[model samples]
Target: MRQDRAIRTRNLILESMASLFNEVGYDAATIAALVERTGLTRGALYFHFASKEDMARAVLDEAVTREGLSPQAFKLQEWVDLGLLLAHRLPREPILRAAIRLAVDPKARRLFGTRWPDWVALGRELLTEAKESGELLAHAEPAAVSRAFVGAWTGVQLVTEDLEEKLNLSEEIAGLYELLLPSIATPAVLAKLDLAPYRAERLLRKSCGQETPEHE
Candidate 1:
Protein backbone atom coordinates (compact mmCIF):
# COMPACT_ATOMS: atom_id res chain seq x y z
CA MET A 1 0.00 0.00 0.00
CA ARG A 2 2.83 2.40 0.81
CA GLN A 3 4.56 1.50 -2.46
CA ASP A 4 1.33 2.07 -4.35
CA ARG A 5 1.01 5.51 -2.83
CA ALA A 6 4.56 6.34 -3.74
CA ILE A 7 3.97 5.28 -7.32
CA ARG A 8 0.81 7.34 -7.48
CA THR A 9 2.56 10.41 -6.17
CA ARG A 10 5.36 9.95 -8.69
CA ASN A 11 2.84 9.70 -11.48
CA LEU A 12 1.06 12.83 -10.31
CA ILE A 13 4.34 14.72 -10.35
CA LEU A 14 5.10 13.55 -13.86
CA GLU A 15 1.61 14.43 -15.04
CA SER A 16 1.84 17.93 -13.62
CA MET A 17 5.27 18.41 -15.16
CA ALA A 18 3.98 17.23 -18.53
CA SER A 19 1.13 19.72 -18.44
CA LEU A 20 3.52 22.60 -17.80
CA PHE A 21 5.98 21.39 -20.42
CA ASN A 22 3.16 21.14 -22.94
CA GLU A 23 1.86 24.66 -22.34
CA VAL A 24 5.28 26.26 -22.18
CA GLY A 25 8.53 24.76 -23.42
CA TYR A 26 11.07 23.12 -21.13
CA ASP A 27 12.84 26.36 -20.23
CA ALA A 28 9.62 27.73 -18.83
CA ALA A 29 8.62 24.59 -16.96
CA THR A 30 10.36 25.58 -13.78
CA ILE A 31 10.63 23.53 -10.61
CA ALA A 32 8.58 26.11 -8.72
CA ALA A 33 5.93 25.88 -11.35
CA LEU A 34 5.84 22.11 -10.99
CA VAL A 35 5.49 22.39 -7.20
CA GLU A 36 2.67 24.92 -7.51
CA ARG A 37 0.92 22.87 -10.19
CA THR A 38 1.24 19.61 -8.33
CA GLY A 39 0.40 21.06 -4.93
CA LEU A 40 3.22 18.97 -3.58
CA THR A 41 5.80 20.25 -1.16
CA ARG A 42 9.24 21.02 -2.52
CA GLY A 43 10.70 18.16 -0.52
CA ALA A 44 8.10 15.75 -1.84
CA LEU A 45 8.65 16.81 -5.42
CA TYR A 46 12.40 16.58 -5.01
CA PHE A 47 11.98 13.16 -3.49
CA HIS A 48 10.54 11.91 -6.77
CA PHE A 49 12.65 14.08 -9.13
CA ALA A 50 15.93 15.61 -8.13
CA SER A 51 15.37 18.49 -10.53
CA LYS A 52 13.20 19.70 -13.39
CA GLU A 53 15.72 18.27 -15.86
CA ASP A 54 15.24 14.82 -14.37
CA MET A 55 11.49 15.10 -14.91
CA ALA A 56 12.05 16.21 -18.49
CA ARG A 57 14.38 13.26 -19.12
CA ALA A 58 11.83 10.86 -17.70
CA VAL A 59 9.18 12.22 -20.09
CA LEU A 60 11.55 11.99 -23.05
CA ASP A 61 12.65 8.49 -22.14
CA GLU A 62 9.08 7.19 -22.37
CA ALA A 63 8.05 9.75 -24.95
CA VAL A 64 6.63 7.53 -27.62
CA THR A 65 5.59 3.95 -26.89
CA ARG A 66 3.99 1.29 -29.08
CA GLU A 67 1.10 0.62 -26.75
CA GLY A 68 -2.53 0.42 -27.95
CA LEU A 69 -1.69 -0.33 -31.57
CA SER A 70 -3.70 -3.22 -32.98
CA PRO A 71 -1.93 -5.67 -35.22
CA GLN A 72 -2.76 -5.77 -38.93
CA ALA A 73 -2.36 -8.42 -41.61
CA PHE A 74 0.02 -6.06 -43.36
CA LYS A 75 3.00 -4.67 -41.45
CA LEU A 76 2.99 -1.59 -43.67
CA GLN A 77 -0.58 -0.93 -42.63
CA GLU A 78 0.56 -1.28 -39.02
CA TRP A 79 3.26 1.32 -39.63
CA VAL A 80 0.75 3.69 -41.20
CA ASP A 81 -1.56 3.22 -38.24
CA LEU A 82 1.26 3.99 -35.83
CA GLY A 83 1.80 7.45 -37.34
CA LEU A 84 -1.91 8.09 -37.79
CA LEU A 85 -2.66 7.11 -34.21
CA LEU A 86 0.10 9.38 -32.87
CA ALA A 87 -1.31 12.26 -34.92
CA HIS A 88 -4.78 11.51 -33.64
CA ARG A 89 -3.65 11.33 -30.00
CA LEU A 90 -0.92 13.98 -29.77
CA PRO A 91 -3.22 17.00 -29.84
CA ARG A 92 -5.41 15.50 -27.17
CA GLU A 93 -2.67 14.23 -24.88
CA PRO A 94 -0.51 16.89 -23.27
CA ILE A 95 2.08 14.34 -22.09
CA LEU A 96 2.85 13.25 -25.63
CA ARG A 97 2.76 16.85 -26.80
CA ALA A 98 5.24 17.78 -24.08
CA ALA A 99 7.56 15.02 -25.22
CA ILE A 100 7.48 16.29 -28.79
CA ARG A 101 8.18 19.83 -27.63
CA LEU A 102 11.22 18.63 -25.69
CA ALA A 103 12.41 16.54 -28.61
CA VAL A 104 12.44 19.51 -30.96
CA ASP A 105 13.85 22.06 -28.55
CA PRO A 106 17.58 22.48 -29.04
CA LYS A 107 18.39 23.11 -25.38
CA ALA A 108 16.17 20.38 -24.04
CA ARG A 109 17.49 17.93 -26.63
CA ARG A 110 21.06 18.62 -25.48
CA LEU A 111 20.04 17.76 -21.94
CA PHE A 112 17.81 14.82 -22.84
CA GLY A 113 18.45 13.28 -26.23
CA THR A 114 15.65 13.10 -28.75
CA ARG A 115 13.79 9.81 -29.27
CA TRP A 116 14.11 9.97 -33.07
CA PRO A 117 16.47 7.00 -33.21
CA ASP A 118 13.94 4.86 -31.36
CA TRP A 119 11.24 5.93 -33.77
CA VAL A 120 13.50 5.27 -36.72
CA ALA A 121 14.33 1.83 -35.35
CA LEU A 122 10.66 1.03 -34.92
CA GLY A 123 9.91 2.16 -38.45
CA ARG A 124 12.83 0.18 -39.81
CA GLU A 125 11.62 -2.96 -38.08
CA LEU A 126 8.13 -2.66 -39.55
CA LEU A 127 9.38 -1.73 -43.00
CA THR A 128 11.78 -4.68 -42.92
CA GLU A 129 8.92 -7.01 -42.11
CA ALA A 130 6.83 -5.53 -44.90
CA LYS A 131 9.71 -5.88 -47.34
CA GLU A 132 10.26 -9.50 -46.36
CA SER A 133 6.57 -10.13 -46.99
CA GLY A 134 6.96 -8.66 -50.50
CA GLU A 135 4.82 -5.62 -49.71
CA LEU A 136 7.57 -3.21 -50.70
CA LEU A 137 9.12 -2.47 -54.08
CA ALA A 138 12.10 -4.59 -55.08
CA HIS A 139 14.51 -1.73 -54.51
CA ALA A 140 13.00 -0.47 -51.25
CA GLU A 141 15.70 -0.56 -48.61
CA PRO A 142 14.07 -0.65 -45.18
CA ALA A 143 16.83 1.12 -43.26
CA ALA A 144 17.14 4.06 -45.66
CA VAL A 145 13.39 4.31 -46.20
CA SER A 146 12.64 4.20 -42.47
CA ARG A 147 15.20 6.93 -41.74
CA ALA A 148 13.78 9.14 -44.45
CA PHE A 149 10.22 8.44 -43.39
CA VAL A 150 10.96 9.40 -39.77
CA GLY A 151 12.62 12.61 -40.91
CA ALA A 152 9.66 13.47 -43.12
CA TRP A 153 7.23 12.63 -40.35
CA THR A 154 9.03 14.90 -37.89
CA GLY A 155 8.97 17.69 -40.47
CA VAL A 156 5.28 17.15 -41.16
CA GLN A 157 4.33 17.44 -37.48
CA LEU A 158 6.44 20.57 -37.01
CA VAL A 159 4.84 22.16 -40.04
CA THR A 160 1.37 21.14 -39.03
CA GLU A 161 1.89 22.53 -35.54
CA ASP A 162 3.28 25.77 -36.92
CA LEU A 163 0.30 26.16 -39.23
CA GLU A 164 -2.41 25.38 -36.65
CA GLU A 165 -1.08 23.82 -33.45
CA LYS A 166 -1.86 20.35 -34.84
CA LEU A 167 -5.48 20.93 -35.76
CA ASN A 168 -4.59 19.33 -39.08
CA LEU A 169 -2.13 16.66 -37.94
CA SER A 170 -4.17 13.69 -39.07
CA GLU A 171 -4.91 15.29 -42.44
CA GLU A 172 -1.27 16.25 -42.92
CA ILE A 173 0.04 12.78 -42.08
CA ALA A 174 -2.54 11.15 -44.34
CA GLY A 175 -1.37 13.35 -47.21
CA LEU A 176 2.23 12.46 -46.39
CA TYR A 177 1.54 8.75 -46.74
CA GLU A 178 -0.46 9.27 -49.90
CA LEU A 179 2.46 11.01 -51.55
CA LEU A 180 5.24 8.74 -50.26
CA LEU A 181 3.68 5.29 -50.18
CA PRO A 182 3.45 4.97 -53.93
CA SER A 183 7.21 4.97 -54.26
CA ILE A 184 7.73 2.26 -51.64
CA ALA A 185 4.69 0.00 -51.66
CA THR A 186 3.79 -2.54 -54.32
CA PRO A 187 0.57 -1.95 -56.28
CA ALA A 188 -1.55 -4.50 -54.44
CA VAL A 189 -0.38 -3.47 -50.99
CA LEU A 190 -0.73 0.21 -51.88
CA ALA A 191 -4.31 -0.39 -52.95
CA LYS A 192 -5.07 -2.04 -49.60
CA LEU A 193 -3.68 0.75 -47.44
CA ASP A 194 -6.14 3.13 -45.78
CA LEU A 195 -4.59 6.57 -45.52
CA ALA A 196 -7.59 8.39 -44.16
CA PRO A 197 -7.49 11.19 -41.61
CA TYR A 198 -9.88 9.23 -39.37
CA ARG A 199 -8.15 5.90 -39.89
CA ALA A 200 -6.84 5.84 -36.33
CA GLU A 201 -10.22 6.63 -34.82
CA ARG A 202 -11.81 3.87 -36.85
CA LEU A 203 -9.13 1.49 -35.71
CA LEU A 204 -9.77 2.38 -32.09
CA ARG A 205 -13.48 1.91 -32.53
CA LYS A 206 -12.95 -1.47 -34.12
CA SER A 207 -10.62 -2.41 -31.30
CA CYS A 208 -13.33 -1.71 -28.73
CA GLY A 209 -13.88 -4.69 -26.43
CA GLN A 210 -10.88 -6.36 -28.03
CA GLU A 211 -7.44 -7.06 -26.66
CA THR A 212 -4.83 -5.18 -28.67
CA PRO A 213 -1.42 -5.87 -27.16
CA GLU A 214 1.50 -3.49 -27.03
CA HIS A 215 4.62 -3.85 -29.17
CA GLU A 216 8.04 -3.82 -27.59
Candidate 2:
Protein backbone atom coordinates (compact mmCIF):
# COMPACT_ATOMS: atom_id res chain seq x y z
CA MET A 1 0.00 0.00 0.00
CA ARG A 2 2.83 2.39 0.74
CA GLN A 3 4.39 1.62 -2.61
CA ASP A 4 1.06 2.15 -4.35
CA ARG A 5 0.60 5.53 -2.70
CA ALA A 6 4.12 6.53 -3.60
CA ILE A 7 3.54 5.55 -7.21
CA ARG A 8 0.32 7.55 -7.32
CA THR A 9 2.00 10.62 -5.87
CA ARG A 10 4.92 10.33 -8.29
CA ASN A 11 2.59 10.01 -11.26
CA LEU A 12 0.54 12.99 -10.11
CA ILE A 13 3.65 15.09 -9.88
CA LEU A 14 4.81 14.03 -13.34
CA GLU A 15 1.41 14.68 -14.90
CA SER A 16 1.17 18.10 -13.32
CA MET A 17 4.70 18.95 -14.40
CA ALA A 18 3.97 17.78 -17.93
CA SER A 19 0.91 20.02 -18.17
CA LEU A 20 2.85 22.98 -16.88
CA PHE A 21 5.69 22.39 -19.33
CA ASN A 22 3.27 22.11 -22.24
CA GLU A 23 1.56 25.37 -21.39
CA VAL A 24 4.82 27.26 -20.95
CA GLY A 25 7.93 25.95 -22.70
CA TYR A 26 10.63 24.18 -20.71
CA ASP A 27 12.69 27.25 -19.90
CA ALA A 28 9.61 29.10 -18.70
CA ALA A 29 8.44 26.25 -16.51
CA THR A 30 9.97 26.49 -13.02
CA ILE A 31 9.97 24.62 -9.76
CA ALA A 32 7.76 27.24 -8.14
CA ALA A 33 5.28 26.93 -10.97
CA LEU A 34 5.19 23.17 -10.52
CA VAL A 35 4.76 23.56 -6.80
CA GLU A 36 1.73 25.74 -7.40
CA ARG A 37 0.40 23.52 -10.16
CA THR A 38 0.57 20.30 -8.18
CA GLY A 39 -0.41 21.89 -4.88
CA LEU A 40 2.61 20.10 -3.45
CA THR A 41 5.33 21.71 -1.43
CA ARG A 42 8.69 22.30 -3.06
CA GLY A 43 10.12 19.46 -1.02
CA ALA A 44 7.45 17.10 -2.21
CA LEU A 45 8.22 17.94 -5.83
CA TYR A 46 11.93 17.64 -5.13
CA PHE A 47 11.38 14.23 -3.61
CA HIS A 48 10.34 12.94 -7.03
CA PHE A 49 12.66 15.09 -9.16
CA ALA A 50 15.98 16.71 -8.36
CA SER A 51 15.43 19.73 -10.58
CA LYS A 52 13.36 21.13 -13.44
CA GLU A 53 15.81 19.62 -15.92
CA ASP A 54 15.52 16.31 -14.15
CA MET A 55 11.76 16.32 -14.54
CA ALA A 56 12.06 17.21 -18.22
CA ARG A 57 14.56 14.41 -18.76
CA ALA A 58 12.21 11.97 -17.04
CA VAL A 59 9.44 12.97 -19.44
CA LEU A 60 11.77 12.60 -22.41
CA ASP A 61 12.58 9.09 -21.25
CA GLU A 62 8.96 8.18 -21.92
CA ALA A 63 8.90 9.83 -25.32
CA VAL A 64 9.49 6.72 -27.45
CA THR A 65 7.75 3.86 -25.67
CA ARG A 66 5.24 1.48 -27.37
CA GLU A 67 3.07 0.82 -24.36
CA GLY A 68 -0.34 0.82 -25.99
CA LEU A 69 0.69 -0.66 -29.35
CA SER A 70 0.31 -4.36 -30.14
CA PRO A 71 2.22 -6.44 -32.65
CA GLN A 72 0.78 -6.68 -36.17
CA ALA A 73 1.11 -9.30 -38.92
CA PHE A 74 2.90 -6.78 -41.07
CA LYS A 75 5.76 -4.87 -39.41
CA LEU A 76 4.87 -1.89 -41.59
CA GLN A 77 1.37 -2.01 -40.18
CA GLU A 78 2.87 -2.01 -36.71
CA TRP A 79 4.85 1.10 -37.59
CA VAL A 80 1.71 2.85 -38.85
CA ASP A 81 -0.19 1.83 -35.78
CA LEU A 82 2.48 3.38 -33.57
CA GLY A 83 2.31 6.73 -35.37
CA LEU A 84 -1.49 6.84 -35.43
CA LEU A 85 -1.66 5.96 -31.77
CA LEU A 86 0.82 8.74 -30.90
CA ALA A 87 -1.31 11.24 -32.82
CA HIS A 88 -4.42 10.17 -30.97
CA ARG A 89 -2.74 10.18 -27.58
CA LEU A 90 -0.58 13.32 -27.88
CA PRO A 91 -3.44 15.75 -27.39
CA ARG A 92 -4.66 13.86 -24.37
CA GLU A 93 -1.28 13.05 -22.87
CA PRO A 94 0.46 16.10 -21.49
CA ILE A 95 3.72 14.24 -20.96
CA LEU A 96 4.00 13.46 -24.67
CA ARG A 97 2.97 16.95 -25.75
CA ALA A 98 5.41 18.50 -23.34
CA ALA A 99 8.21 16.22 -24.46
CA ILE A 100 7.69 17.21 -28.08
CA ARG A 101 7.62 20.87 -27.18
CA LEU A 102 10.82 20.57 -25.16
CA ALA A 103 12.48 18.62 -27.96
CA VAL A 104 11.88 21.49 -30.35
CA ASP A 105 12.70 24.33 -27.95
CA PRO A 106 16.23 25.55 -28.56
CA LYS A 107 17.01 26.46 -24.98
CA ALA A 108 15.63 23.25 -23.57
CA ARG A 109 17.15 21.15 -26.31
CA ARG A 110 20.57 22.64 -25.68
CA LEU A 111 20.33 21.93 -21.97
CA PHE A 112 19.03 18.40 -22.48
CA GLY A 113 18.97 16.79 -25.88
CA THR A 114 15.70 15.57 -27.40
CA ARG A 115 14.45 12.01 -27.93
CA TRP A 116 14.20 12.47 -31.70
CA PRO A 117 17.04 10.05 -32.31
CA ASP A 118 15.34 7.36 -30.22
CA TRP A 119 12.17 7.75 -32.24
CA VAL A 120 14.11 7.50 -35.49
CA ALA A 121 15.87 4.39 -34.24
CA LEU A 122 12.58 2.70 -33.43
CA GLY A 123 11.16 3.60 -36.83
CA ARG A 124 14.23 2.26 -38.60
CA GLU A 125 14.02 -1.00 -36.67
CA LEU A 126 10.39 -1.50 -37.66
CA LEU A 127 10.95 -0.49 -41.28
CA THR A 128 13.97 -2.80 -41.55
CA GLU A 129 11.83 -5.70 -40.41
CA ALA A 130 9.16 -4.76 -42.93
CA LYS A 131 11.74 -4.64 -45.70
CA GLU A 132 12.99 -8.10 -44.76
CA SER A 133 9.38 -9.31 -44.93
CA GLY A 134 9.03 -8.09 -48.54
CA GLU A 135 6.64 -5.31 -47.62
CA LEU A 136 8.64 -2.38 -49.04
CA LEU A 137 9.41 -1.27 -52.58
CA ALA A 138 12.75 -2.18 -54.16
CA HIS A 139 14.09 1.33 -53.92
CA ALA A 140 12.94 2.01 -50.35
CA GLU A 141 15.73 2.36 -47.79
CA PRO A 142 14.73 1.84 -44.16
CA ALA A 143 17.35 4.17 -42.68
CA ALA A 144 16.59 7.08 -44.99
CA VAL A 145 12.84 6.55 -44.95
CA SER A 146 12.73 6.31 -41.17
CA ARG A 147 14.64 9.57 -40.72
CA ALA A 148 12.47 11.37 -43.28
CA PHE A 149 9.26 10.05 -41.77
CA VAL A 150 10.26 11.20 -38.29
CA GLY A 151 11.06 14.65 -39.60
CA ALA A 152 7.74 14.79 -41.44
CA TRP A 153 5.87 13.62 -38.38
CA THR A 154 7.52 16.26 -36.24
CA GLY A 155 6.77 18.96 -38.81
CA VAL A 156 3.13 17.90 -39.02
CA GLN A 157 2.77 18.13 -35.26
CA LEU A 158 4.38 21.56 -35.04
CA VAL A 159 2.43 22.98 -38.00
CA THR A 160 -0.89 21.61 -36.80
CA GLU A 161 -0.34 23.11 -33.35
CA ASP A 162 0.54 26.51 -34.78
CA LEU A 163 -1.92 26.83 -37.68
CA GLU A 164 -5.06 24.86 -36.77
CA GLU A 165 -6.39 24.88 -33.25
CA LYS A 166 -9.08 22.29 -34.00
CA LEU A 167 -7.29 20.01 -36.46
CA ASN A 168 -7.14 16.34 -35.50
CA LEU A 169 -3.60 15.02 -35.46
CA SER A 170 -4.66 11.43 -36.12
CA GLU A 171 -6.22 12.53 -39.39
CA GLU A 172 -3.18 14.61 -40.27
CA ILE A 173 -0.81 11.73 -39.57
CA ALA A 174 -2.97 9.35 -41.55
CA GLY A 175 -2.77 11.75 -44.48
CA LEU A 176 1.01 11.73 -44.11
CA TYR A 177 1.08 7.94 -44.36
CA GLU A 178 -1.24 8.01 -47.33
CA LEU A 179 1.13 10.31 -49.19
CA LEU A 180 4.40 8.66 -48.16
CA LEU A 181 3.48 4.99 -48.14
CA PRO A 182 2.89 4.83 -51.85
CA SER A 183 6.57 5.51 -52.39
CA ILE A 184 7.82 3.10 -49.74
CA ALA A 185 5.42 0.20 -49.78
CA THR A 186 4.87 -2.28 -52.59
CA PRO A 187 1.62 -1.92 -54.54
CA ALA A 188 0.13 -5.01 -52.94
CA VAL A 189 1.19 -3.99 -49.46
CA LEU A 190 -0.09 -0.45 -49.90
CA ALA A 191 -3.46 -1.71 -51.08
CA LYS A 192 -3.84 -3.87 -47.99
CA LEU A 193 -2.98 -1.05 -45.56
CA ASP A 194 -5.59 0.69 -43.40
CA LEU A 195 -4.63 4.32 -43.01
CA ALA A 196 -7.90 5.52 -41.54
CA PRO A 197 -7.69 8.38 -39.02
CA TYR A 198 -10.10 6.72 -36.64
CA ARG A 199 -8.06 3.52 -36.57
CA ALA A 200 -6.59 4.46 -33.21
CA GLU A 201 -10.00 5.06 -31.67
CA ARG A 202 -11.24 1.70 -32.90
CA LEU A 203 -8.06 0.06 -31.64
CA LEU A 204 -8.61 1.58 -28.19
CA ARG A 205 -12.17 0.33 -28.08
CA LYS A 206 -11.10 -3.15 -29.07
CA SER A 207 -8.36 -3.12 -26.43
CA CYS A 208 -10.90 -2.15 -23.79
CA GLY A 209 -13.19 -4.99 -24.80
CA GLN A 210 -15.80 -2.52 -26.00
CA GLU A 211 -17.65 -3.44 -29.17
CA THR A 212 -16.49 -1.34 -32.14
CA PRO A 213 -18.78 -1.10 -35.14
CA GLU A 214 -17.64 -3.05 -38.17
CA HIS A 215 -18.07 -0.05 -40.45
CA GLU A 216 -15.42 1.85 -38.61
Candidate 3:
Protein backbone atom coordinates (compact mmCIF):
# COMPACT_ATOMS: atom_id res chain seq x y z
CA MET A 1 0.00 0.00 0.00
CA ARG A 2 2.85 2.36 0.80
CA GLN A 3 4.43 1.55 -2.54
CA ASP A 4 1.15 2.16 -4.32
CA ARG A 5 0.72 5.47 -2.59
CA ALA A 6 4.26 6.37 -3.53
CA ILE A 7 3.51 5.57 -7.14
CA ARG A 8 0.34 7.62 -7.00
CA THR A 9 2.17 10.56 -5.47
CA ARG A 10 4.88 10.32 -8.07
CA ASN A 11 2.31 10.21 -10.84
CA LEU A 12 0.58 13.20 -9.31
CA ILE A 13 3.88 15.05 -9.19
CA LEU A 14 4.60 14.23 -12.83
CA GLU A 15 1.11 15.24 -13.91
CA SER A 16 1.40 18.49 -11.99
CA MET A 17 4.80 19.15 -13.49
CA ALA A 18 3.62 18.41 -17.01
CA SER A 19 0.78 20.93 -16.73
CA LEU A 20 2.95 23.59 -15.08
CA PHE A 21 5.78 23.18 -17.59
CA ASN A 22 3.28 23.04 -20.41
CA GLU A 23 1.67 26.33 -19.34
CA VAL A 24 4.87 28.16 -18.38
CA GLY A 25 8.34 27.77 -19.83
CA TYR A 26 10.81 26.18 -17.44
CA ASP A 27 12.82 29.33 -16.74
CA ALA A 28 9.73 31.34 -15.96
CA ALA A 29 8.31 28.64 -13.67
CA THR A 30 9.15 28.49 -10.01
CA ILE A 31 8.68 26.11 -7.09
CA ALA A 32 6.05 28.45 -5.78
CA ALA A 33 4.13 28.12 -9.00
CA LEU A 34 4.42 24.37 -8.86
CA VAL A 35 3.31 24.34 -5.27
CA GLU A 36 0.43 26.66 -6.00
CA ARG A 37 -0.64 24.65 -9.01
CA THR A 38 -0.36 21.27 -7.29
CA GLY A 39 -1.26 22.28 -3.77
CA LEU A 40 1.54 20.03 -2.62
CA THR A 41 3.84 21.11 0.14
CA ARG A 42 7.51 21.68 -0.59
CA GLY A 43 8.33 18.55 1.36
CA ALA A 44 5.91 16.52 -0.67
CA LEU A 45 7.36 17.81 -3.91
CA TYR A 46 10.85 16.92 -2.76
CA PHE A 47 9.66 13.51 -1.73
CA HIS A 48 9.20 12.77 -5.42
CA PHE A 49 11.91 14.92 -7.07
CA ALA A 50 15.29 16.12 -6.03
CA SER A 51 14.99 19.33 -8.01
CA LYS A 52 13.03 21.02 -10.75
CA GLU A 53 15.40 19.66 -13.35
CA ASP A 54 14.74 16.18 -12.04
CA MET A 55 11.06 16.88 -12.24
CA ALA A 56 11.53 18.23 -15.75
CA ARG A 57 13.24 15.01 -16.74
CA ALA A 58 10.33 13.11 -15.25
CA VAL A 59 7.95 15.32 -17.23
CA LEU A 60 9.88 14.76 -20.43
CA ASP A 61 9.77 11.02 -19.93
CA GLU A 62 6.09 11.17 -19.08
CA ALA A 63 5.42 13.02 -22.34
CA VAL A 64 7.02 10.26 -24.39
CA THR A 65 5.66 7.38 -22.34
CA ARG A 66 2.09 8.66 -22.58
CA GLU A 67 2.34 9.51 -26.28
CA GLY A 68 0.94 6.07 -27.31
CA LEU A 69 3.66 5.90 -29.95
CA SER A 70 6.39 4.01 -28.17
CA PRO A 71 7.68 0.76 -29.64
CA GLN A 72 5.38 -2.25 -29.63
CA ALA A 73 6.27 -3.85 -32.94
CA PHE A 74 4.56 -1.16 -35.02
CA LYS A 75 4.73 -1.41 -38.82
CA LEU A 76 6.66 0.99 -41.05
CA GLN A 77 3.73 3.23 -41.89
CA GLU A 78 2.67 3.05 -38.28
CA TRP A 79 6.19 4.04 -37.29
CA VAL A 80 6.05 7.03 -39.64
CA ASP A 81 2.65 7.91 -38.28
CA LEU A 82 4.01 7.71 -34.76
CA GLY A 83 7.13 9.71 -35.53
CA LEU A 84 5.18 12.42 -37.30
CA LEU A 85 2.66 12.36 -34.51
CA LEU A 86 5.35 13.34 -32.02
CA ALA A 87 6.77 15.87 -34.42
CA HIS A 88 3.32 17.40 -34.69
CA ARG A 89 2.64 17.20 -30.97
CA LEU A 90 5.79 18.97 -29.75
CA PRO A 91 5.58 22.26 -31.64
CA ARG A 92 1.90 23.05 -31.05
CA GLU A 93 2.22 23.56 -27.31
CA PRO A 94 4.43 26.44 -26.23
CA ILE A 95 5.08 24.95 -22.83
CA LEU A 96 5.95 21.46 -24.13
CA ARG A 97 8.16 22.99 -26.81
CA ALA A 98 9.88 25.02 -24.15
CA ALA A 99 10.44 21.89 -22.10
CA ILE A 100 11.91 20.20 -25.16
CA ARG A 101 14.18 23.20 -25.61
CA LEU A 102 15.15 22.97 -21.97
CA ALA A 103 15.86 19.26 -22.29
CA VAL A 104 18.25 20.01 -25.15
CA ASP A 105 20.01 22.88 -23.40
CA PRO A 106 23.69 22.52 -22.50
CA LYS A 107 22.82 23.17 -18.89
CA ALA A 108 20.20 20.44 -19.00
CA ARG A 109 21.64 18.24 -21.70
CA ARG A 110 20.83 15.10 -19.77
CA LEU A 111 17.37 15.31 -21.24
CA PHE A 112 18.92 14.77 -24.65
CA GLY A 113 19.38 11.13 -23.75
CA THR A 114 15.84 10.98 -22.44
CA ARG A 115 13.56 13.11 -24.67
CA TRP A 116 15.71 14.12 -27.65
CA PRO A 117 17.00 10.61 -28.09
CA ASP A 118 13.53 9.07 -28.28
CA TRP A 119 12.26 11.45 -30.99
CA VAL A 120 15.01 10.29 -33.31
CA ALA A 121 14.61 6.71 -32.20
CA LEU A 122 10.95 6.95 -33.10
CA GLY A 123 11.89 8.16 -36.57
CA ARG A 124 14.46 5.44 -37.09
CA GLU A 125 12.05 2.76 -36.01
CA LEU A 126 9.48 3.96 -38.52
CA LEU A 127 12.02 4.28 -41.30
CA THR A 128 13.23 0.76 -40.66
CA GLU A 129 9.70 -0.52 -40.77
CA ALA A 130 9.29 1.19 -44.16
CA LYS A 131 12.36 -0.69 -45.25
CA GLU A 132 10.49 -3.91 -44.57
CA SER A 133 7.85 -2.74 -47.03
CA GLY A 134 10.78 -2.22 -49.45
CA GLU A 135 9.71 1.38 -50.02
CA LEU A 136 12.75 3.31 -48.78
CA LEU A 137 15.96 4.16 -50.60
CA ALA A 138 18.24 1.11 -50.67
CA HIS A 139 21.20 3.29 -49.79
CA ALA A 140 19.35 5.23 -47.13
CA GLU A 141 20.37 5.10 -43.49
CA PRO A 142 17.16 4.72 -41.53
CA ALA A 143 18.56 6.05 -38.23
CA ALA A 144 20.06 9.18 -39.74
CA VAL A 145 17.01 9.81 -41.89
CA SER A 146 14.80 9.31 -38.90
CA ARG A 147 16.70 11.95 -36.93
CA ALA A 148 16.35 14.33 -39.84
CA PHE A 149 12.61 13.75 -40.04
CA VAL A 150 12.09 14.64 -36.40
CA GLY A 151 14.60 17.49 -36.63
CA ALA A 152 12.93 19.06 -39.63
CA TRP A 153 9.56 18.99 -37.93
CA THR A 154 11.07 20.57 -34.82
CA GLY A 155 12.79 23.27 -36.86
CA VAL A 156 9.50 24.17 -38.48
CA GLN A 157 7.81 24.35 -35.08
CA LEU A 158 10.54 26.59 -33.67
CA VAL A 159 10.28 29.01 -36.57
CA THR A 160 6.50 29.22 -36.52
CA GLU A 161 6.24 29.59 -32.75
CA ASP A 162 8.99 32.19 -32.45
CA LEU A 163 7.80 34.23 -35.39
CA GLU A 164 4.15 33.82 -34.31
CA GLU A 165 3.12 34.96 -37.76
CA LYS A 166 0.41 33.60 -39.95
CA LEU A 167 1.65 30.14 -40.90
CA ASN A 168 1.12 28.25 -44.11
CA LEU A 169 0.68 24.70 -42.90
CA SER A 170 0.33 23.35 -46.40
CA GLU A 171 3.57 24.89 -47.47
CA GLU A 172 5.33 23.62 -44.37
CA ILE A 173 4.00 20.09 -44.85
CA ALA A 174 4.89 20.13 -48.53
CA GLY A 175 8.39 21.29 -47.71
CA LEU A 176 8.81 18.55 -45.14
CA TYR A 177 7.57 15.89 -47.56
CA GLU A 178 9.91 17.21 -50.22
CA LEU A 179 12.85 16.79 -47.87
CA LEU A 180 12.04 13.33 -46.45
CA LEU A 181 10.29 11.72 -49.42
CA PRO A 182 13.54 11.96 -51.34
CA SER A 183 15.55 9.90 -48.88
CA ILE A 184 13.26 8.05 -46.51
CA ALA A 185 10.31 7.10 -48.71
CA THR A 186 10.39 5.36 -52.04
CA PRO A 187 7.66 6.47 -54.43
CA ALA A 188 5.74 3.41 -53.25
CA VAL A 189 6.37 4.09 -49.58
CA LEU A 190 5.81 7.78 -50.09
CA ALA A 191 2.45 6.92 -51.49
CA LYS A 192 1.76 4.84 -48.42
CA LEU A 193 2.77 7.19 -45.57
CA ASP A 194 -0.13 9.58 -45.81
CA LEU A 195 0.94 13.06 -44.69
CA ALA A 196 -2.41 14.80 -44.60
CA PRO A 197 -3.70 13.59 -41.25
CA TYR A 198 -0.29 14.04 -39.64
CA ARG A 199 -0.11 17.62 -40.85
CA ALA A 200 -3.68 18.36 -39.85
CA GLU A 201 -3.12 16.88 -36.40
CA ARG A 202 -0.28 19.26 -35.62
CA LEU A 203 -2.47 22.25 -36.36
CA LEU A 204 -5.19 20.72 -34.23
CA ARG A 205 -2.73 19.92 -31.43
CA LYS A 206 -1.44 23.49 -31.40
CA SER A 207 -4.98 24.79 -31.22
CA CYS A 208 -5.62 22.57 -28.23
CA GLY A 209 -3.32 22.24 -25.22
CA GLN A 210 -0.06 20.98 -26.68
CA GLU A 211 0.61 19.02 -23.54
CA THR A 212 -2.48 16.89 -24.11
CA PRO A 213 -3.80 16.44 -27.68
CA GLU A 214 -6.46 13.86 -26.75
CA HIS A 215 -9.79 15.39 -27.86
CA GLU A 216 -8.23 17.51 -30.54
> Which candidate tops TM-score?
2
Q: Report lDDT (CA) for all predictions.
A: 0.86, 0.87, 0.63
User: Per-residue alpha-carbon lDDT of model 2 for 1-216, expressed as tens digits?
Assistant: 988988899889888888888888787888888787788998887888888888888899888867556777889998998899889989888999988988888998998899989899999999999999999999999999999999999899989988846988999999999999999999998888889998888776666664643222
lDDT score, candidate 3, position 43: 98
Per-candidate RMSD, Å: 2.5, 3.9, 6.3
RMSD of candidate 1 to the truth, in angstroms, is 2.5
Better of 1 and 2 by lDDT: 2
| Model 1 whole-model lDDT (C-alpha atoms) | 0.86
TM-score of each: 0.87, 0.92, 0.67
Clashing pairs in 2: none
Instruction: Please give, for residues 110-194, the per-residue lDDT of candidate 3 as tens digits.
Output: 4435465776776676678767767677987888876776677667756765676787544564567666676655666566555
